[model samples]
Target: MRDFMDYVLTAFHHKTGWNVDNSYASLTTTANNLLDFNVPHGLSLHVSSLSSPNFATSYTLGSKGVVDGSLSFLYTSLGLNVTSRSSHIPLANLVRGYRHLQHLSLPKGKALNDVQDGGTSIAGDGRKDTLLYGRLYLPSSSLEALYLRRLSPNRLLRLNCVSDATLPSGGTVLALLQNDFGKYTTEYLYSTDSSLLGFRALYNFGYDPRYPLDQQHVSSRPARHPWDHQNGRLSAGAEAYFSPINKSGGISTGLRFTTLPIHTGFPYTMTLTLNPLMGNLSSSYAVKAGPNLSLCSRFDFNVYSYESDVSLGLELWQLSRPRVPEEVAWVKDLIRPGWEPKVAPEKVVPDEDVTGVLKARMTDKGKVGVVWECRLKELLVTLGAGLDLKKRDSVVGKFGLEVAYSS
Candidate 1:
C-alpha cells in the first residue's frame, strides 16, 4: 500500500530478474530523429545523431544534449550535454567540507559521475553544478535538518527542517519546512488515535504572484491565504476500514475547496482487490490544456469539446510459434538441405510478427478512428481509418496504411 496509488507486484521466487533492455536506447534514437524536424526559434539541429547509445556499460548509456541559442556566433553549439549512470563516478579528489555526524552525499559513486561529467559540460554560459548535501536526523529529539549547496551553475543553497512528536494519548504530529533560498513551503500532519484519523495542511509562501487575486479571500491573513488574491484553499477527507488489514480492501473520499471564484469538488476513489484481478479508480477536477495530458472524466469537458486522440492498446505474450509459409519453406529447402532460420526464443520481442502505425494523433476534429496492427518477424503493418462522427459522408472519410522495418 503505497501513496499516490502506485502499486507494483513482483515474484520473489523468479529465477531471473526483471529485464531492462535497449528500449530506452531505441527511444533516444527516435527522439533525435524527431528533433531533426521543425527547428525551434534561434536553434539549429545538428545533422549527426546526438542520441548515440553508450556501449561502454554492460547496458546502453542514457544520452541527453542541448542547443545553446545564446551562442549564435559559432557555427556549432557548445558541448553542454552528458550521458552517465549512477555507478560511474568521477572527480572524488575535489570535494571539500566536513560533518561526520550528519548524513552527507560526500564521496561515492554519485560524486565520481558528477566530476567526470562536470568538466565536459560546457554548453551554455550557465556554470556546471557540483552538489554537496548533508542532513542531521535525531530520532530521540524528534528533530531533523538538512542543507545542500551547489558549487557551480551559480551558487545555490537549500535548507530543510522536520520534527515528529508522539503524545501520551497515542497520537503523533509531524512538521516539515523547506526553503531554496527564495520561497518556503511548510507542511503539518496530525494523526489521532493511532492513524484512525489524520489531518494535513500546507502553506506555500513563494507561489507565483501573477495569477489574478482571489477576490473571495482578499481580507484573509497571509497564513490562510498563501497565494495573492486567493481565498483560503482547504481540503479535508476521511478513510474507512473494511475487511482484514493487508488481506482485504477499503474505500476513501476527499475534497478540496476554495472560497472565492467558486471552486470545489469531492475526490472519489476506490480500490478493488479480488485474487488475480485488481485495479484502482480515481477522479480529479483539473482541466487539461494539452494533448499530452490525460483528459479528466469530469473536469476536462464542457458543453462543446474536441477529443481527437482516442487510443486502444494491445500486447500479446506467450505467443505460439507460427509455421513457416509453404512457399517460403519450399524456397528454403531448395537453397540447402534441412535449412532453417535462427530465432532467439528468450528475447521478449518474439520474431513471429511485427508492424505498426508508427505514429498517430488527433490532428483533426469531429473524427473517430480505428487502427489495427500486426507484427510479422521484423516487419510491422498498420491499417487504419477515420470517419467524421457527426456526418456519414463516405467521400470525407480517411484511410491510411503504414509499414515499419525493425531489427
Candidate 2:
C-alpha cells in the first residue's frame, strides 16, 4: 500500500509542478482501529507555495501550475470476513492567488462483509456490500456558492431456497442490487450595489428533493431499504434595491422576481418586494404583492395577489470572498490564442440487440407561485403561496425564517 501511494504521489508531481508529502507514519493506532485496519494506515500531505518561480501562476501562459493530491487505503480482517476502504482527496489551485478555486474532490470507498458464514443460516444470509461517496464545495462568498455530491451503494446476497432442506427442495440464489443519489446547487447574491442592479439567483438540482435543507439525507429509505431515488430541481430569481438609500435610520424597500422548475413542468414563478422602515413605526404599514404563474402539459396559467411580511431584527457584519484563482486562470487559458488541450473524441457504438423500449408522456399539469421576503436586523423571514390552475386546482404555501448573531 505504501509503495502504491508513493507511485501515485510521484505521478502527480511529474504531471504538475507541486510538492507532495505524507504523514502516514504519524497516524495513531486508535485511528487505524477505527478503519478496522490490522496494520498501520498510511497518510500523505502535499503542499506547494504559490510564490515559487517554477510554478505558473496562470494557465493562460501555458504554464504548469501547483496541484495537490492524496490517497489513503486500509484493509482489515475480523472473525470470518475482511473489509477494505479507501479515500482520495485532490485539490488544484492556481499558482497566482485567485479568489475562486479551480478543482476540488473528495472520494471515499467502503466494503463490508467480504466473506459470510455458510453453515449458520439466519433469517437472511449475510451479504457483502460496498459504498462509494463524494462531495465538492465551492463557496465564492457568503452570498455566492456551488456544491455537488454523489453516492452509490452495491450489495451482493446469497440465499438458501428452502427453510429446511433435507431433500433437494432447496436451491441456492445470488443477487446484486445498486442504488445512486446526487445533488447540485448554485447561488449568487448582489447586495444593493449602485453600479449594478441588486439581483440574486439560486438554483438547486438533486435526485431527491425531500431533503431540501439537509445535507446528510443522501438516501430516501434510510430506515428500511435506505436507498435514494433520482430527483432534481432548478430555481432562479432577481431583486432590485430601492428607497431609503441615503437615509441611515429610516425605512428600506426592494423588488424581487423568481421562477422554479421541478420535474416535467414549465415553471412555478412569482414576483414581489416590500418596505418596512419608510412608513409609520407605531402602526407599521407594509405592502406585499406579486404575479404568479404555472405551466404544465404546455399549458400556462397566471395570477396576482398582495401580502405583507413584518419583522424586527438587528444588523451584523458581512464577509465576502473572491472566486477561486485556479478556476479563473483555467477560464482565461481556454480563451487565450493558440491554447488548446487535446481531448480524445468519443467512439460511437451501436446497440445490436433489440430490447424493451420505454417512453414518457405528460398529462395533467398545474402550478401556483407566490413569494414574500423581509429582513429586520438579525431576523429574516420569507413566505410563498401559489395555486395550481389545472383540472384539479390546489393551493400551496411555504414559510421560512432564519436568525443570526449581530456584532
Candidate 3:
C-alpha cells in the first residue's frame, strides 16, 4: 500500500511540478535561513566516516569544564541518535529550534530541485527510495522521535513524540496532516501538550499544480498572461489554533511573493505576516542581487505597543572559476526551452577556489552576530561571535570555534 502511494505521488509531481515551499509555514523560510544565525558559545568538534554518510559523532566542551558527546547513525530509512551528559549542556542550547535538514547533504551533482522531485531514488542507485522514514533521539534525560509518511501526491502525515522526566504529563505527542490542493494547501495539527487543535490554509493567487483536474475549467482556461512569465508568484494564508483546556484561541495571516525556480532571473522573496490578536506585524525582503551576494532585511512592529525594530543580514561568498573552460558553458545553459535543466556531472572544484563564506546579521537593538565558514585542507572550520553594543562592559557576549573532519 505504501509503495503504491509513493508511486502515485511521484507521478503526480512529475506532471504538475508543484513545489514543497508552497506550504503556509514555509513562506519566510528563505529569509529566515539568512537572518537566523546561531550564536555558538563553546568549543565543538564533529567527526564522521567518509566511507559512510550515515554515521557521525560530536563533542562539545562548554563552560565550567562541562562536556557533552553524542553518536548518531543513519541506516536506510531509520535514524538513531544518542547523547551523553546532555544535562550538563546549557538548557538554552537544547531547547532551541530544531531544523530537520540541518545535517542533510545533497549527493554530488544533484541540484536541490532534482532531489525534491517526489522522493524518487537517484538513477542507478540500487537503493530503493523509502516511503516511510523515522528518527529517534535519545538523550540522558529525554527522548524524541519523528516519523513521516507520504499518503498521496497531495497528502502527508507526520507524528512527533517527546518524553522527559521534567514534564508533568511525562510525554507529549503531535500529529500533523497536510493536504496540497492544486490551487491551495491546508494543514491540520493536534498536540497533546496543551490539548491544542490547529488548522492552516494557503491559497496561491498564481498558478499551482495541486489543483484537481475536475476543478480546472478547461474550456475557460485563459492564455498565459505576460506577467505570469515575467513576474513571480503570490500566495496568501492564515492559521488558527485553539486550546480547549485553556479556552483560548489565536489566529494569524500572512502573504508571500516569491520567484519560482524557473524564473531564470534575479531571484527574490518578500513576505508579510500579521497577528491581530497580539497586534504584531512583521515583514521581510530577501534578494539575490548578484551571483555571489545576497541580502535580507526584516521589520517588526507591535501596533498596540507602538514598538518597532529592523534587522539586516547578508551572505558573501568566495568562488573560484571552474577548472575546465568547457564546463563554463553549463552556466549559460540555465534554462531549456520547455524542460527542467538536467543536473550536470559532478565537477571537482579547485581546492583553492570556491573556498569560504561570510554570513552576518545585525539588529537595531545593537545585537550583532557574524559567522565565517571555510573549508580547510581536510576539515571544515567555522568561527562565530556575538556582540551587544548597548553593553558598557562585556561587549563581546559570546564566541566559539567549530571544526569537522571526515575520514
Candidate 4:
C-alpha cells in the first residue's frame, strides 16, 4: 500500500508543478507520512516575482486530527514597483463535522493613483492600512435515529482602522479612523431520509466615515470638501432541495430578498438548478428582477470518462437583458434636470427599449493523470478552448491549457 501510494503521489507532483512555489528544503519528508497516521497536516509556502521589482509570497497551513477536527491558517503579502505593499491573513476552525469559526485580516496601502503621475506631485501616495474581520458559525448534526439536533445561532464581528499621513508644508497631520461592524445570522436546516430544506435570516449594522482630500497646491485654495454617507442593509432567504426521481437528476430552488431602508423598493432574486438526466448533464437558470432585470442560463455535459481517472466536458452560458423604463430613469437621475441623458436625442426617449446578449462556450479536450503527488495526490491536464460572443460587438476567442490537482 505504501509503495503504491508513493508512486501515485510522485506522478501527480511531477505533472502539476506541486510544491513549485516554496523552497522544498524547508519541508521534511516526514510531512508525507503524517497523513497515514490519521493525522492530516500540510503546509505550502511560495514566493514569485513579476519582472524585477514586483513580487508576492504566500503561506498556507492546515491540520486535521481525530481530536481537534480541522484548523487552517493562511497569510499572503504582495509588493509591486517598490512603492506599493499589501497583506492579508485568514484562519478557520471546524469541529464536530461543522464549520465553527473563521477570521480574516486585510491591510492595504493608499490608493496607487499617485504612481501614474511622473513625479511625486503629492498625489501618488502609497501608505499602509490595517483591517481585521472575523465570524463564528454553528452547524447541526444528527446523532442517532431517535434524537433530533439543532444548530446554534452564528455571530460575526469586524473591526478596521485606517492610519495614513500626507506630506504637506504645514506639518505632519495624523489622518486616522476606526470603525466596528457586526452581524448575527441564524439558519434552520432540515433533512429527511432523502430530501433537504433550509431557511436563514441575518441582521447587520455598521458605520464608517470618509476623510477630506488633502490639497498640496501652496497658494490659497478652497478647503478640500468633506462628504460622509452611512447606510445599512437587511436580507433573508429560503432554499429547498429535492432528491432525484427515478433516473432523473435532482432539483434545487432558492429565493432571496434584500432591503435598503433608505432606498425605495426592495430587491429580490430567484435561482434554480435542474439535472434532467441523472447522467453527466445539468442545466441552471436564474432570473433577477428588482431594480434591474437579468436573465441567465447555463448547460454542462460530461463527454467522456476513463476509469474514474480522467474526464472530458463542455459547458455553455448565456446572459441577456432588455432595456426598460427603469434604466431610462436611472440615466436621467445622473444628469442635471434640464440636460437630457447624452445619446442621439432622437434615440433618447422615456419608453425606448434596448436588448443586449452575451454568450460563452467552453470545451475540454482530455486529461492525463499521475502528474504529481505526495499525500492525497491527483493530477489532470487538458486543453480547453472558449468563445465569447456579444451583441453588436466582435466575438472573442480564448485558448488555454488546463491543469487540475487535488490532495
Candidate 5:
C-alpha cells in the first residue's frame, strides 16, 4: 500500500510539472492582448531586409494629417529604437520581469548560439556563464536605456534610465533585482523618479518540486489521474510600494488559475486582482472556445466610487485553400483530339498555407474595435477599425490599413 501511494503521488507531480510559473504582473496579459492592443487609424508602412533581419523601419500617417516614423534594430541580446513620439514603458520586460532562470555551462563555441536558440543540454549544476543585454530608445531627442544581467541561475538584475533635456533633474533611474526558488519568486524594485521602493512575490499553492520556473527537471511519464492533467496550476501573489519622500504606500494582491489544453481539452485561464488601498477589484477570463476560436472577458469595479465596467473580446482564424483549375491540360485533351490549353499553370504562393487572424472587442461604454491581420508570400497586412455606438450621426468611424514587406 505504501508503494502504491508513492507511485500515485509521483504521477500527480508529473501532471503539474507541465506548466510553468507566471510573473505576478502578468496575470492579465492574455486579456489585455485581446482587449487593449492599440488599433491603427490611418495608412502605415513597414519594410525589412532578409539580409539584415535585425533592422526594420516603419512610417504612419494618421487621419489628422499627423505623420510619424520609427527605425528599429532588434537582436537576441541587443535592441535599439528611434521614433518621433514617446511611448509607454515596455511591460514585458519592466513590469513582468523574467519568467524563469537559465543555468548554462556549455562550451565556449556553442554557448551563445545555444542560448539564443533556447537549446538545452546536460551541464554542471551551476552556471559558469555571464550574459548582458541592453536596449535603447530615443524619442524626440530624449533617451531611455535598459540593461539586464543574470547573476546566477536563481538571481537577475536590471537597470533603466530615462534622460530628457527639459527635466529639472535631467533624468531618472530605476533598478530591479529578482530571485526564483523552486516554489516561489520574489522581486525588489527602486526608482529614482519618485524615490519609491517596491517588493513583489508570487507563490504557487500546488507547486511541483520537479519543475520549477527554471525548468531544470523533466519527465516523460503520463498522468494517472485525468483530472490532474486538466487543472494545470494555481498561484497567488502580492505587491507593495512606498515612497520615503512622500511618506505614502499602497498594496495590491492577485490570484491566477489556469488549465492546460491536453488531449483536445478546452483550456481556460482566470485572474482576479484587488487593490484595497484604492477600493478596486478586477477580474478577467480567457478561454479557447474551439480549435480556431478564442474568447475573453474582463470586468472592473471601484467599490468606493461605485463605478463599474465590462468588456468582451474574441479571436478567429481563417485559412484559404488552394484553387484548382477547372480546365487542365488533361481535361482539354478529352475535348480536342490533339490540342492542349495554351495557358500556364497558376503561380502558387510559397506561404499560401498560412492562416489569417481576426480579433474584435466591445466595451460597455459603447466602443467597438475590429482588427484583421494576414500574411502573403512576402508581405503582411493589417486592417483595423473602431466605432462609437453612441455617435449615430457619424456614418463611419476610424479605420486604417498597414502593410509590411520583407525580402
Candidate 6:
C-alpha cells in the first residue's frame, strides 16, 4: 500500500509540476526542497518539476544525505541525462585525511528545431554531449597559497565534445589550477599552445576558504585565448560583492562577449542581479521574505534587445515550535484539553522545522503569477494561478491534494 501510494503521488507530482520561486494558490512553497523522501532502503528520492504555458516541461532530481557514493538521472521534453558521481573513489581514498569528489554528465537530445513535416512529434535523438567535473582538497600549512587546490577539465569543469578528424577523442580538454591570497587571488590555466590568466580582489567575501561555493564565474575570461584558440567565448566583469553580517544582501553584475566566425546575431550582453533577505520572528510565528531580481541587455553591435523580471517570495517557517515531551506517542487525539484553535502541526520528526514559501512573479510583458505551499505533518500541498494583461497568454498552474496512511 505504501508503494502504491508512492507511485500515485509520484505520477501526480510529475503531472502537475510546481515551481519553488512561485507555486500554488498564493499559499505555501518550499525553496530548495520541493519533494524529498528518505526510505528505509538505501535509496533516496529528490524530485523538482516546473511547467508554464508555452514553455517546455522540465524535470530535475538530486540525491541528498547519501553517505558514500552518487548516481543521478534527469529527463525533459528534450531528452534524457545521466550522471556518475563519487566522493571517495579508489584513487582518491588511498591517502588518508584527503577528501575529493568527481562528476561526469552525458546528455542526449534533438536539435533546436528538429521537427517533422506533419507536426512536432517528440524526438529524443539529436546531438550527444558530455561534461566532466572534479574537485580535490589538500592540507593547508605555512608555505602554501594554493592550499585546497583544484585541477578541473576546464576552467568551469565543463567541455564541448565534437567528433572530427583534426582532434583526438580523449587526450586533454583543458586544465586549471587556482591560487588563493588573503583578500585576493590569481590563477593560470594552460597547455602547450593555449593559456588563460586571471585575477580578483575582495573585502570580506566570507567564502568557505576550504570549499568556495561561488567559484563558477558566469561572466569572466580566464584564458587569454579560449580552449585551443578555436572557441572564442570570453567575458570581463566585476566579482560579486557581499554585504556585512547584519544584512546578507548584495549585488552582482557582469558583461560577456563572444567572437565567432559564423554568428553575427549577438555580439555582447550585460547582466545585473540583486538579492535581499528580510526576517521576522515572534513568540508564536516566524516569517521570512527574500526577493531576487535581475536585468539583462543584449547588443548586436547595431540594435539592442533588453529584458527584466522579478520574483517576490515569502516563507512561513514555524508555528510556536512544539515543546518536547518525556514520552513520545505517534497516535494521540488532536484535541487534548482547552482548545480555542483546535490543533497545530503534528510533531512527526521531532525538532525539525517545517517551512513553506509563498511567492509571486511578474514578466516584462505584464503577466503576473502567484504561488503558495504548505505542509501538514508529512503531507505537502501547493497551488498557483496566473493572469496576463493582453489576455492571450496561457496561465500554467498547479493545484493538488494528497493523503496517506503510515502502514
Q: TM-scores, in order shown?
A: 0.22, 0.18, 0.70, 0.18, 0.67, 0.27
Model 1, runs deviating above 4 Å? 1-299, 303-366
Error of 5 at 32 (Å): 1.0
Per-residue lDDT tens digits for candidate 5, residues 266-359, read: 5567889999999999999887665456788999999999999999998765647654432244345657876632322222222334356788
lDDT of 5: 0.55
Alpha carbon lDDT of residue 379, candidate 3?
A: 62
lDDT of 4 by residue, 135-159 (tens): 1111211111111111100111112
lDDT of 3 by residue, 152-190 (tens): 445667687777778879989999998776468899999
lDDT by residue (77-114, candidate 2, tens digit) is: 21111111111111111000001111111111122222
* Candidate number achieving the greatest TM-score relative to the actual structure: 3
Give the Cα lDDT of each candidate. 0.25, 0.22, 0.59, 0.23, 0.55, 0.25
- The 10 consecutive residues of candidate 4 with the worst lDDT sum are 89-98
**Going through the candidates in order, what is the number of backbone clashes in each?**
17, 22, 3, 12, 0, 14
Expressed as tens digits, the lDDT of each residue in 218-252 for candidate 1 is 44554332332333233333333323323444443
TM-score of decoy 2 = 0.18
> Which of the predicted structures, 3 or 5, would earn the higher lDDT when compared with the native?
3
**Local lDDT at 265 for model 6:** 24
In model 2, state the lDDT of residue 240: 34
Tell me the TM-score of model 5. Answer: 0.67
lDDT of 2: 0.22
